[model samples]
Target chain A: MKKFFLGFALVSLLIAGVLSYFASGDPDGLDKTVEDTGIAAHAQEHPFAGSTFADYALGGDSKFTGLAGALGVIVVLAVSFSLFWFLRKRPDAR
Target chain B: MHMSDGLLNAPVSVAFLVIAAVGVGFALVKARADLDDRTAPMAGLVATFIFAVQMINFPILPGASGHLLGGALAAILVGPYVGALCVTIVLVVQALLFADGGLTALGANVTNMALIGTATGFVVAVALRRLAERGKGGLAAVAFVSAFVNTVVAATGFVVEYAIGGAGGVEIGKVALLMWGLHALIGIGEGLITAATVTSVAAIRPDLVYLLRGSRKPLEVRS
Candidate 1:
C-alpha cells in the first residue's frame, strides 16, 4: 500500500511539474465569463498579488514555474496529512 | 471557478464565509468519526492529487478553459464527508498560497466546489450505482455521470451567488445562462477525467473506492 501510494504521489508530482506547463493559458470559464460580460473591469487584483510565488510561479521562467508547481503539491500533501493525522481516529484510544 | 474579490459585496462575502466555515467545520467533525489511520492517508492523498490536477486546464470553448474540480472524484474515492473536507483544504491552500481563488471569496468558492459539488455528486453517484447492475462497467459509467452533474451544479451555484451578490451590470439571467452553458462543456472534460481516474483506481485498488465497496464480491467457483 505504501509503495502504491508513493508511485501515485510521484505520478501526481510529475503531472504537476511537467504537464502543467502544457496547460492552456487561456482564461478559465469564470474569467472568460467576466471578460465576455464586460465585468472584467470590476475584478480587482488579489491583495497578495505581490507575494512570492503568486500565480503559482516566480518569474515566468518555465522551469521555475514547474518546480513551484511541484512544491505546491508537496505543500498541500504536508498540510493535509498534518490535519488528517490529528483528525483520524486512533484505534488504541478506545 | 475561482471568483475574485469585488464580484460580491462585503455582506454577501461575509455571509458565505460564515456558511462555508460552518459547513467545513461540520464536515471535519463528521469525517473524524469515520477516519481511521488507513483512511486518513487516502483522504490526504486525494486532496494533494486534486490540487495538482487542478493546475491543468483544458480548453472547453473558444478562449475559455476549465480544470478538474475534484469534488465528485474525491467523494467517489472516499466518502462525501471527508471528500468535502479534502476539497475545502485544497481551496483554502489555493486561496492563501497560490492566490488561485480570492481570499475574500474563499467562502463562496468552498461552498460551491466543496459543499455543494461533493454532496450533489455523491448523491448522484449513489443513486446511479443503485440503479445499475453490479460488477460491470456500471460503476465507472455512474462515476462519469456524477462528475458531469457535479460541475453543472457547481456552476449553477455561482449563478445563485451572483444573483444574490453580483456587483456587475450584466443581466443576472444572461450570466446564469452563459455560466451554465460554458460549464456544461467544461463538465464534459471533468466527467471524462473522473471516469478514467475512478476506473483506473477501481481496477488496481478496488478497496480504496468507497462507492465500489458494495459492488465488489468474492470470485465464484465454477460448478
Candidate 2:
C-alpha cells in the first residue's frame, strides 16, 4: 500500500511537471473573457508573484530552474500524499 | 475558468467565497459515507487522471484553446460531494503550485467550477439516469448531457462575474452572449470526452460510477 501511494504520488507530480510545459500561455476562458470585455488589466498580480516558484519557473533561466520546478512538484506531491495517507490510514477512523 | 483577483467585484467575489465555503463543508460531510479504504485511493487516482487529462487542449476558435474543466466528469464518475472536493483540490493545486490560477480568486473558481459545475452536473446526471433507466446506451448519453450543461453553466458564471467588475465599458449583454455561445460549442467537446471516459469506466467497473448507481446491471457479452 505504501509503495502504491508513493508511486502514485511520484507519477502525479511527474505528470504535473510535464503538463506545465504544454499548458497554454494563451489566456484561459476567464482571462479571454476579461480581455474581450476590456477588464483584463483590472486583474491583480498575486501577492506571491515575487516568489521564485511563481509562474511555474525557478529563479534563474538555467536548466536548473526547470529541473527544480519538476523536483519541487514531486516534493509537494509526496508531502500531500503522505499527509492524506496518514490522516486516513487510521484503521478505526474510517 | 479561473477568475483572478480584481477581476470580480468585491461583492461578487465575497458572495462566491461564502458559497464555496458552504459547498466545501457539505462535500466533506457527504463524502464521509463514500470514503472507504478502497474508494479513497480511487478518488485520488480519478483526481490525478482529471488533472492529467485537463492538460490536453482543444481549439475553441481560430486562436483560442480550452481544456477540460472535468467537474461533470468527476461528479458523474464519483459522487457529487467527492466530485466537488476532487475538482476543488485540483483548482487549489493549480493556483498555489502551478500558478495556473490566482490565489485570491480561489474561492470564485471553486464556487463556479467545483461547486456549481459539479452539483449541477450531478443533478442533471441523476435526472437523465432516471429517465434512461431501462434503455441501452443511456448512461453515455446522460454523461454527455451532464458534462455539456456543466460547462455552459460555468461559462455563464464567468460572464456574470465580468459584468459586475468589468473595467472596460463593453456591453454586459454582449459579453454574456458571446461567452455563452462559444462555451456551448466547447461544451460539446467536453461532453464527448467526458462521456467516453465515464462510459469506459462503467463498462469495466460500474460500481465506480456513482451517478449510474441502481440504473441497470452491467452487460456481459461472452464470446
Candidate 3:
C-alpha cells in the first residue's frame, strides 16, 4: 500500500513537472488584464532573480531542464512527507 | 495564479507574507484538532489529485489557458486548515523544486492562492451549505461559488499589488475590472471541477468531507 502511494505520487509529480513547462508563458488571465489596462509592466524584478532555479529552467537544455524539474518535485515531496511523518506522533510512540 | 518574483512591490509582498503567516498559524492549530491518521492520508491524496487536475489546462478564450486553482476543492474535501496547508505545500514544492513559481514570490503565491483563496472559498461554502440545508446538491453549489470567489479574490490581490508598485502611471480601475471579468470566466471552470470533485467524494466517503458537517441529511430515516 505504501509503495502504491509512493508510485502514484511519483507519477503525478512527473506529469506536473512536464505540464508546468508547457503552461502558457503568456500572461495568464490576471496578467492579460494587467497588460491590457497598462499596469502589467509594474511588476518588479525579484531580488533572487540570479538564483540558479530562478526560472523554470536551471540553465540547461529543454530536456535536461525538464528532467531537473521532475527530480525537484520528487525531492520536495519526499522532504515534505518525511517532515510530516516525523512530526506525527505514534499512537504509543509519543 | 503563481505570481513570479519581482511581480509585486516589496511592501505589498511583505504584507501578504504577514497575512499568510497568520493564516498558516491558524491552520496549524485547527489541523491539530481535525487531523487524524485517516485525515492525513486523505489530505495527501487530495493534494496529489489537485496536482494532476492542475495539469489539464483549459483554454480561457481563444489562446489563453487556465487550469484548476484547487483551493476551494481542497478546503471543501478536507477541513479548511488542512486544505490550506495542502495547497501551500504544493506551491512551496512547485516554487523550490520545479521552479514553477519564483522563489522570492513564494510568499505572495501562498498568500493569494493558499491563504486568501482557501479562506474565502471555505467561507462561501459554509454560507451556501447553510442556505441549501445540507442537501446533496448544496455541496456542489457551495463548491462552485467558493471556487469562483477564491479566483476573484486572488485577482483582486494582484490588482492591489500593482497599484502599490506600478511601473509608471496607469489606470488601476480599468486593470481591476478587466482582471476581475476574465477571472470570473476562469472561475467558472474552477467552480465546475471543484463541485464535481466534492460531489464524487461526498458520494463515496461522505464522512470525509469537512464542509458537509451537521448539514449532511440522513440518508434514510429510521422507521
What is the iRMSD of the candidate numbered 2? 3.4
User: Candidate 2 docking category?
Assistant: acceptable
Provide the TM-score of chain A alone for each candidate, in the order shown: 0.92, 0.64, 0.71
Name the candidate, 1 or 2, with the larger DockQ value: 1
TM-score of each: 0.95, 0.82, 0.80
Preferred candidate (TM-score higher): 1 or 2: 1
On a 0 to 1 TM-score scale, where does candidate 3 land against the true structure? 0.80
Q: Write the per-residue lDDT of candidate 2 for residues B22-64, one digit (tens) a residue.
A: 9888887777666666566656766766666565566777656
The prediction achieving the highest DockQ against the true structure is 1
Worst window of 10 by summed lDDT in candidate 3 chain B: B214-223
Listed models, DockQ each: 0.80, 0.32, 0.32
Instruction: Give the Cα RMSD of candidate 1.
Output: 2.4
TM-score of chain B of each: 0.94, 0.91, 0.90
Tens digits of lDDT, candidate 3, B102-181: 66567677887888888888888777767434555776778888999998997787777768764455677877788788
TM-score-based ranking: 1, 2, 3
What do the candidate models score in CA lDDT, each in turn? Answer: 0.84, 0.70, 0.69
